[model samples]
Target: MLRRVREGLHRWPAVARLVAIAALLLVAAAAHLAARSEPAGRWLPLLVVAVVGALVAGAPRHRWPLPAIWLVATVLAVTRGSAVDPGATAAALGVGAVALVAALTADVVPVLRTRHRRGER
Candidate 1:
């Protein structure tokens, strides 16, 4: 059973990353709503995003920066979501989610397919 799961993930890496993002996004979105409900807490998520963005991007060795970028944008969505109605908010979030996945795919797939060719005899 576990082997099958591993093989499936290996064959479809995007699905694995997507499941992770979906799980985290649910929590972050809920956090957004909770923070909104409390006037004093509204800025906390945004502030956290800024701090983390600085920390992550500041380091050159953070090889995979896509997740960090997605996280910041997702948090930003919560901050700016107030101006729009619920339906529009959901659609916008959906678009952002797609963008996040697309960005990751664009950054990763080509590199994975490329061969170093340097060491090949």
Candidate 2:
């Protein structure tokens, strides 16, 4: 069973990323709704679009940057503007940004090492 799980992970990094992003987005969306004073204007719709944009780009090779970019945007918007509930946006966006950066960096480092190994051989 363990072996099977490992193989599945190897074959589907994208799925892992997709699931992670979806989970984070759920938390953010819920928080956005639950906040005592979320914006009454366009922030809700923008947040929705950001979540969907991340979802649509959830490929391991490509979507690696999507969540990070989304999170940064969210963070900036929250910090600079008075749209969404800052605390809720900060929590979800912070975690999502960090996780995506780590995952994508780890993924790329391995490829670079493998290429160097081939060159040496």
Candidate 3:
């Protein structure tokens, strides 16, 4: 069973990446909601940061960064933003900005590497 799951992930890495990101987003959303009325709610934004960071770190090498960024941004906006109340708006925006910056970095790093390689030739 474990071997089959690993093989499936290897065969469809992009799908696996999307699913992983989606799962993280869901966890973040749930954390945001659960902590909303608690004293620990202030710390929930960190969870958002962690989720976006994980997504960026695990971004697929061969896929465009836009889809993952878009999914995270949209999910954060809907789940962490005003849908819950004004309280979550700040966390949503902050996390969204982080995700955007990470996306830019993901796109830029490969291009820079390719350019450097060509220059060496």
Candidate 4:
């Protein structure tokens, strides 16, 4: 299933990535709105930032460290806030896990570099 998803996205290149990023942003917005009781104005910017970071790091040429930095910063900000609702836990966990995996290895960077190099040739 995961392989199929990856392959399907790979078939369309930038379009697929853009759609995926947009969907991720939508999800973030929805999650933020649903999970937190605070004013939308407060968390909307953070949601936007998260989406922007995800989009920037969505490409094959982007290093995992870039996204990792964004994720770390976001997590710190979220935690520092006075209240954290349980509903946002899924997004936090999922993205956090991805960032952790990226931080622990050079997998994403090397794969992207190789693909980029091949494309250049």
Q: State in Å the error of residue 33, model 4.
A: 8.8
lDDT of 3 by residue, 24-120 (tens): 5654554445334334455456455545544544444433343344445545545644544445545544555676677668778989999999999
Best candidate (score: lDDT): 2
TM-score of each: 0.33, 0.43, 0.45, 0.33
What is candidate 2's lDDT per residue for 1-121, written digit by digit as tens? 6456545655787875665566456535543443324553534565555555444444345545545555655555566556566566666576666868887887789899999999998
Candidate 3 deviant stretches above 4 angstroms: 1-8, 12-59, 62-84
* Candidate 3 total steric clashes: 0
List the pairs of residues colliding in candidate 1. none
* Model 2 regions lying over 4 Å from their true place: 1-58
RMSD of each: 11.4, 8.6, 6.5, 9.4
Candidate 4: residue 9 lDDT (0-100) = 64
Error of 3 at 30 (Å): 5.1
- lDDT scores of the candidates, listed in order: 0.49, 0.57, 0.54, 0.55
Error of 1 at 94 (Å): 0.4
- Global lDDT of model 4: 0.55
TM-score of 2: 0.43
Q: State the lDDT at 112 in candidate 2.
A: 95
